[model samples]
Target chain A: MKFNILIFTHATATHYPMNYLASIGSYAIMVREVFKKPTKWRIMKSLILKEIDDLIFGSLGIIIFISFFIGGVVAIQTALNISNPLIPRNLIGFATRQSVILEFAPTFTSIIMAGKVGSYITSSIGTMRVTEQIDALEVMGVNSLNYLVFPKIVAMFFYPFAVAIAMYIGILGGWIAGVFGGFSSSADFVEGLQLDFIPYHVTYSFIKSVVFAFVIATVPSYHGYYMKGGALEVGKAATVSFVWTSVVIIILNYVLTQLMLG
Target chain B: MIEVKDLHKAFDGSPVLKGISTVFEKGKTNLIIGQSGSGKTVFMKCLLGLIIPDSGTICYEGQIYSQLTPEQQRDLRQEMGMVFQGSALFDSMTVEGNVMFPLEMFARQSRSEMQDRVEFVLRRVNLADAHKKYPAEISGGMQKRVAIARAIVMNPKYLFCDEPNSGLDPRTAILIDNLIQEITREYNITTVINTHDMNSVMEIGEKIVFLKDGIKEWEGTNRDIFRTDNEAVSNFVYSSELFKKVRQMYLEERD
Candidate 1:
C-alpha cells in the first residue's frame, strides 16, 4: 500500500506542472486569437455595450452592499482592538479606510465578483459550447474568441470605476458606524480619513482593480471557451473557473503589494 | 464541389476515418450515412476544416484546403455554411438576429438591404412570424428553420448539415429535409448532409456514401441503394423489419 501510494503521489506531482504550464500556454494562444481577425466595429459596439451592462452594472448592487457592511465591521473591530488609552479614537476610521481601499474594495470585492461574474462567463460560454453555438460561429468564419471574449475584456476596463464607488461607500459606512455606535465623534472619524491619505494609494488600488479585471475576464473565458463535454460539464467548468480565478487574483494581489508597497 | 482524396484521421492512435476518397458534387444532395461511431461527424468536421486530417487533401472547388493560407482558408470558410445537429441557434439573439448575423459579420450591405435579406430568408424558411422570438421561446422545429435560414442568408456555395433532423418529429423532420432539398436545388448549392435517418436517405439523397468502421463500404443513390446486394449495406439498409419488407416490395416492383 505504501509503495502504491508513493507512486501515485509521484505521478500526480510530475503531471500537474506540465498540465498547468500547458493550460497557461493555451490561454496565451486564445488571448492572441481574440486580438486577430477583429469583429466589425458596428456589431462589436452592441456586444461590448451588452457585456458592460451584464458584467459592470449587474455587479454594482452586491459590491455596494458588501462594502458598506464590511466597512462597518472593520470600524467596529478596530475600535475594539485599540486597548491603549494613548491611541487616538480616529485610528478606527484610519483602519477602515486603509482596509477598504488597499484590500477590501479591490481584492476582496474582486474575489466576490469571481463568484458572480466568473461563473456567469463560464456557464454562458460553456453552454454555447455544449449547444454547438460556438461551432456555428466558427463555421460562419467568425473568430469565435474575438466574437465571444473580446467584448468581455473591453467591458471590464470600466471595472476600476466600480471599485472607486466601493471605496467611497465603504468610507461613508465607516463614518456612520463610528459616530452612531458611540465609538468616536464624526469630526474625528472624518479627520482620520483625511490624515496622511496618500494619493498614490488610490492609484495603487485602481491599478490593482484593473489587473484584477483582466484576470476576472480572461480566466473565466479561457475555461469556458476551452471546455468540452455536455451540460453537466458546463456546471463543473463554472466551479473550476471560480477556483482558478480566485487563486490567480490572490497570488497577483500578494505580488503587486510586495512590488508597489514594500 | 468538394473532393476528398485518401482522407485519414485518428485519435490517440486509433483510426476514425481511414483512407476514404469521395467526391461531393455541386447542385446535388450528397448524403453521408452511417451508424454511430462510423466517423460521420469526424468526416463532416474535417470537411468543415474544424478537424485536420492526418493525411490527404480536401479540395474545395480546386482550392486545396491544407495548402491555403490562413486568410485564404477564412475566405473559403465564408463561402461555406453549416447546420449543426442541435440547430445551434444563438440563444441570446432573436430569430431575425440569428439569420442576420452572417450578413452583419461579412457583408458590406446597408442596414435596409441586410434587413430585406433577413426577411427574405426567414420567409423562405416559413419563419416570418417568429422573427422577434428567441430560440428558447420557439419550438425545436422552428429553431432548425432559423438555423437553415442563417446558413443560407450569406448565400454560401456549400451547405453542410450534421443530422439536421435528429430531434424532430417524423412530419417535421420530413418538412425540414424537403426544405433542405428545395433550397439546394433552388440555389444550386453543393449540399452535404451527415445522417443516420433512413427516411432522410430515401427522401433527399441524390448521392449517398455509406461508411462502416471509418471506411467507405458503399456508394450509390437512394434508388440504387434498394438494389445493392453488398451484405453490410443490405443489413444496414434493411435493419428494420419494415424496411426489409419495403425493400422486398421495391425489388419486386422493379422486377
Candidate 2:
C-alpha cells in the first residue's frame, strides 16, 4: 500500500506540468489552424457580424454596471486612506484614475469576460463537438477551425471599444462618488483628473485590452473545439476554459506591464 | 464507388480496426452492419476522411484519398452528402436555414434560386410546413427529414448515412429507410450507410458488409444473408428468437 501510494504521488507530480505543456502546444496548433485558408468571404463576413453581436454587443450592459461601481469604490477607498494633510485633496481623484485606468478597466474587466464570453464560446463549441456538428464540418471538408474560430477573433477586435466605454464610465463613476459622497471636492477631483495625465498610459491600457481580447476569444474556442464526450463534458470544458483564460490574462498582465510600462 | 483496402486504425495502442477491405458499389444502398463496438463508426469516418487511418487507402471513383491534394480533397467532398444519426441540424438555424446552408456555402445561385432549391428539397422531404420551425420545435422524424434535405440540397454525387434509423419508431424508421433508398436510386449516387438495424438490412441492404471486432466477417446481399452459414453473421443477424423463427420460416418457404 505504501509503495502504491508513493507511485501515485510520483505519477501525479509529473502529470500536471506535462499536461500543461501539452495543452500549450495544442493551443498553438489550434491557433495555426484558425488562420488557414478561410471559407468564402461572403460566409465569413456574416459569421463575423454574428460573433460581434454575441460577444461584444451582448456584453455591454454588465460591463458598464460593474465598471461604474468599482470606480466609485476605488475613489471612496482612496479618500479614506488619505490621513496626511501634506497630501493634496485632488490626490484621491489621481489615485482613482490610475487604479481604474491601469488595472480595473483592462485587467479586471477581462477577468470578468473570461467568465462570461469565455464560457459562452466554450459551451457553444463544446456542444457542437459533442453533437458532431464539428464532425459534420470536417466531413464536408470545411476547415472547422477557420469556420468556427476566425470569426470570433475578428469579433474581439471590437472588444477594445467595450474597454474604452468601461474606462469612460469608471472615471465618471469616480467623479459621482468623490463629489456627492463628500470624499473630495468636485474642483479638486477635476483637477486631479487632469494632473499628471500621461497619454502613453491610455495607449498602454488599450494595448492590454487588445491582447486580453485575443485570449478571451481563442482560449475558450480551443477548449470548445477539441472537447470530447457529452453534455457534462461541455460544462467541464467551459469551467476549465474560464480558469485558464483568467490565469493567462493575469500572467500576461504582469509580463506586459513589465515589458511595456515597467 | 468507394473502395477501402487493408484499413487499420488504433487508439492509444488498442487496435479498433485491424485490417478492413471492402468495396461499396455505386447507385445502390451499401450498408455496413455490425455490433456496437465493431468499428463501424471508425470505418465510415475513414471513408469520409474525418479520421486518418494508420495505414490504408480509400478510393473514390478510382482516385486515392491520400494522394489527392487538400484542395482536391475538398473539391471531392463537395460531391458527398451525409445524414447523421442524431440528425445533427444546426440549432441556431431554422429548418429553412438548415436546408439552405450547403447551397449557401458551395452554390453560387442567387437568392431566389437558392430559395427555390431549398423549397424543392424541403418539399421532397415532405417538410413543406416546417420551414420556419427550429430543430427543437420539430419531431424527431421531421428533424431527420430536414437533415436529409440539407444533405441532398447540393445534389451530391455520393451520400452517406450513419445509423439513419436510430431513436425512431418502426414506422418512422421504415419511412427514413425508404426515403434514402429512393434518393439513392433517383440520383444514381454511391450511397453507404452504417447501421445495425436488421430491418434496414432486409428492406434496402442491396450490398451489405458485416463487420465483427473490426474485421469484415461477411459480405453479401440481403437475400444471401438468410442462406449464409457463417456463425458470427448468423448469430448477430438472428440474435432475437423472433428473428430466428422468422429465418426458419423464410428458409422453409424458400425450399
Candidate 3:
C-alpha cells in the first residue's frame, strides 16, 4: 500500500505539467479555429448583437454601482491616512483618480466580470456541449467555434467603453465622498485630480482593458467548448472557468503593467 | 448507399468495433440493434463522420470519406443530417429557429424562402402549431418531431438518428418511427438508425444489423429476424416473454 501510494503521487505530480501544456496548446488551436471559415454574416451579425447585449450592456448596472462605491472608499481611506499636515488635502482626489483608473476600474471590474460574464459564457457553451448541441452543429457542417466564440470576441471589443465609464463614475464618486464627508474640500479635490494628470495613463488603462477583454472572452470560452460530461460538469466548468479567467487576467495585469508602465 | 468495409475502433487500447462490414441501402430504413456497450453509437457516429474509424473505409455513394479533402468532407457533411437520442435541439432557439438553423447557415435563399421551407418541413412533421415554442416547453415527442423536421429541412441525402424513440411512450415512439420511415422513403435517403427498441425494429426496420461484442452477429430483414436460429440474435430479439410468444406465434403461422 505504501509503495502504491508513492507511485500514484509521483504519477500525479508528473501529469500536471503535461496537462497544463496541453490545455494551453488546445486553447491556441481553439482560438485559431474561431477565426477560421467565418459563419455567415447575416447570422453572425445577429449573434454578435445578442452577445453585446449580454456581455456589455447587461453588465453596466453592476460595474457602475461598484465603481461608484469603491471610488468613495478609496478617497476616504487616503484622506484618513494623512497624519502629517504637510500632505495637501488635494491628495485625496489624486489618490482616488490614480487608484480607480490604474487598477480598480480595469483589473478589479474584470475580476468581477470574470465571475459574471465568464461564468455566463462557460455555462451556456458547457450546456450546449452536454446536450450534444455542439455535435449537432458539427454534423450540420457548421464551424461551432466560429458560431459560438467569435461573436463573443467581437462583442468584447467594446469592453473598454465600460471601463472608461467606470473610471469617470469612480472619480465622480470620490469627489462626492471626499467633499460631503468633510475629508477634503471640493476645490482641493478638483485641483488634485488635475495635478500631474498624465495622458498616457488613460492609454495604459485602455490597453490593459483590451488585453483583459480578450482574456475574458476567450479563456471562459475555452473552458466551456472543451468541457465533457453532463449537467453537473457544466456547473463545474463554469466554476473552473471563473477561477482560471481571473487568474489569467491578474497575471496579465502584472506583466502588462510592468512592460508598459515600468 | 453507404458501404462499410472492415470498420474498426478502439478506446484506451480496448477494441470496441473489432471488424465489421455492412451496406445501408438508400431509400430504406436500416436499423442497427444491439445491447448496450455493443458499439452501436460508435458505429453510427463513424457513419456520420463524427468519429474516425481506426481502420476501414466508409464509402458514401462511391466517395471514400477518408480520401476526401477537408473542404470536400465538410461539403459531404452538408448532405447529411443527424437526430441525436436526446432530441438535441438548440435550447435557446424556438422550434422554427431550430429547424431553420441549417438553412440559415448554408441555404442561399431569401428570408421568406427560408421561412417557407421551415414551415413546410414543420408541417410535414405535424409540428406546424409549435413554431414559436422552445424545446423545453414542448413534449419529448414534439421535440423528436422538431428534430426530424430539422434533419430533413435541408433535404439531406443521408439521415442518421441515434435512438429517435429513447424516451417516449410506445405510441409516440411508433409515431416517430413511422415519421422517419415516411421521410426516408419520400426523399430516397440512406436512413441509418441506432435503436434497441424491438417495436421500432418490427415496425420500420427494412434491413436489420445485429451486433454483439463489437462484431456483426446477424444481418437480415424483420421477418428474417423472427426465423433466424442464431442463438444470440434469438436471445436478444426474443428476450421478453411477450416477444417469445410473438415469435412462437410467428413460427406457427408460417408453418
Candidate 4:
C-alpha cells in the first residue's frame, strides 16, 4: 500500500513545470502550436467558412428557438402582472429589447457555447496531448501550437459575432409575440423599443460577445493542451476547463462592463 | 547521430535522469531498454528536444539543439519520425489523411501527388485497404501498423519509437520489432526505441543501451550481451524465469 503511494507520488512529480516561468512560456507555446499549421487543415479558410456555415445552417435556429420560447413566456407573465390597460402596455417590448440585445443574447449564448465549443476544444486537444498525438505533430515538423490553436481562435473571433446576430434576431420573435399576440399594441411596442434603447448598446453586445468567445475558446484549450497522464487526465482537464472558463467569463464580463460601458 | 552529454533532468525536487551521457549511432537501431520509471523516455525526449535538460548539451549531428530557431527546429523535426506507444493516430482523420498530414505540412505536393504518395506508403506498410478507416475503427495491431506507416510516410532520416510493443501480444510485438528494424535497415535511418521487453533486446537490438535508475549500466549488442560478465546485466536479463530456463538449456547443451 505504501509502495503504491510512493510510486503514485513519484509519477506526479514529473508533471510539475520545471521552472517558475514555465507557466507563461507554455501559454505562448500553446498559442504558437495551436496557430502554426494554417495550410495543413485549410484552417484559416475553414474558420471563415465555418462562421458562414454556422450562421446560415445552424446558429439562427438557436436564436429564433430560444427567443420565441422566452418571448412567449415573457408575454404570458407580463399579461397577468398588468391590471391597468391604460398604462403603457408596450413596456414589456421595451424591457425585452434591453434584456435580449444588451444582456441575454450575448451573455446567454456565450454560456451556451461554454458547453459546445468549450467542451470540443478541451476534449479534442486534451485527448491529443494525452495520446501523444501532439508529440507526433511536433516530430513531423508541424507546429502543434500553431496548427491547433490558430483555427480555433480565428473561428472564435467570428462565431460570437454570428451568435450575437442570432440573439438579436431572436429578440424580434419575442417582440412579435408581445405585439402580434395581443399582449401589447404594435405601435406602442415599436415606439417604446426605439425610444428607450441605445443603438451603441448593439456595439457593446458585439464587443462583449467577441470577448466571451475568446475566453470560451482559449481557456478550455489551455487546460487540455497541458494535460498529462491518459484518459482520466483528459476527463479531468475537460472538467477543469468548464469550471475555469465559467469563472473567467464571469470575471471578464464584470471587468469589460466596468471598462467598456460609458 | 545524436550525442547527449552530462544530461541532468529532474522531476520536482528529485532526479529522474541524473547526469547521463550516451551516443546514438547514425544508420543503426539504438535500443534504450529499462524498466518503467528508469528514465529511458526522458532520455529519448531530451534527445528529440521535447524536454530541455538542466545542465547538459544535446548535439544532433554536432549542432547544439537549444540554439536553433523555431523554423530551423521545425525543419530539423522534418528529419525525424516518431511512433508513440498508443499508436497516436488522429481519431478525426482517415488513415490516408493521417499519413498525408506531415507531407502536406512540409512538402509542396499537389493533392493528387499527395494522394499517390499516401497510397504508396500505405502499400509499403501493407495498409493499402485501411486508408479510409478512422483510427478508432481499426484493431490495435492494425493501428500500430498505421502509426509505423505514418512515421515513415515522410521518409525521415531518424526514427524514434516509445515502447513500440507496449500493448501488443508477444507475436504482434515481435512482428512490430522486425518491421521497425527492417524499415530502419532499408532506409538506413537512425532508429531509437525505448522499451523494457527482453524480446526486443535479443531480437533486433543492434546497438543496445541499458538504463538503470537513470544511469547507463551497460551498452552492447545482443550477441555481446549473452557473453558479458557484468552482474547488473546478468541480474536484469536472467531475472526472467523464461530467460533463466533458456540459459540453462543452452549451458547444458554446451557441456
In terms of lDDT, which candidate is strongest?
3
Q: Candidates sorted by DockQ, descending order?
A: 3, 4, 1, 2
> Candidate 1's residue-wise lDDT over A102-190, tens digit each?
99999999999999999999999989988989888888889888999999999999999999999999888888888999999998898
| Candidate 2 lDDT tens digits, B1-255 | 998999999875789998999999888999999999999998898888777788989999999988998788888888899999898889999999989888888799999999999999999989999999999999999999999998899998889999999999999999999999999999899999999899999999999999999999999999999999999999999999988998899999999
Scored against the true structure, residue B99 in model 2 reaches a CA lDDT of: 90
DockQ of each: 0.46, 0.42, 0.50, 0.49
Alpha-carbon deviation at B20 in model 1, angstroms: 1.3
lDDT of 4 by residue, B124-176 (tens): 77788998899989888889989998899888888999899988999989988
Q: Compared with the true structure, what per-residue lDDT tens digits does model 1 show for residues B3-112?
A: 99999998758999999999999999999998899999999989998887889999999999999987788889999999999999998889998999999999999999
Among the numbered candidates, top DockQ falls to 3
Candidate 1 residue runs with Cα over 4 Å from true position: A1-18
What proportion of the real contacts between chains A and B does each prediction keep? Answer: 0.67, 0.59, 0.72, 0.67
TM-score of the second chain in each model?
A: 0.99, 0.98, 0.99, 0.94
Estimate, for each residue in A66-158, the C-alpha lDDT of model 3 and write its tens digit. Answer: 999999999999999999999999999999999999999999999999999999999999898789898899889888889999999999999
lDDT of 4 by residue, A1-262 (tens): 0111222332343356354244445455555545444555464476456644643345556655766666556655665587887767777767677677777777777776776667768888888887888878777877666667666666677765566665556567666777677887777667767865777888888889888877777778777776667788777778877876887788877888888784
User: In model 4, where do residues sit more than 4 Å from their true spots?
Assistant: A1-29, A32-63, A74-87, A176-182, B249-255
Clashing pairs in 3: none
The better candidate by lDDT, 1 or 4, is 1
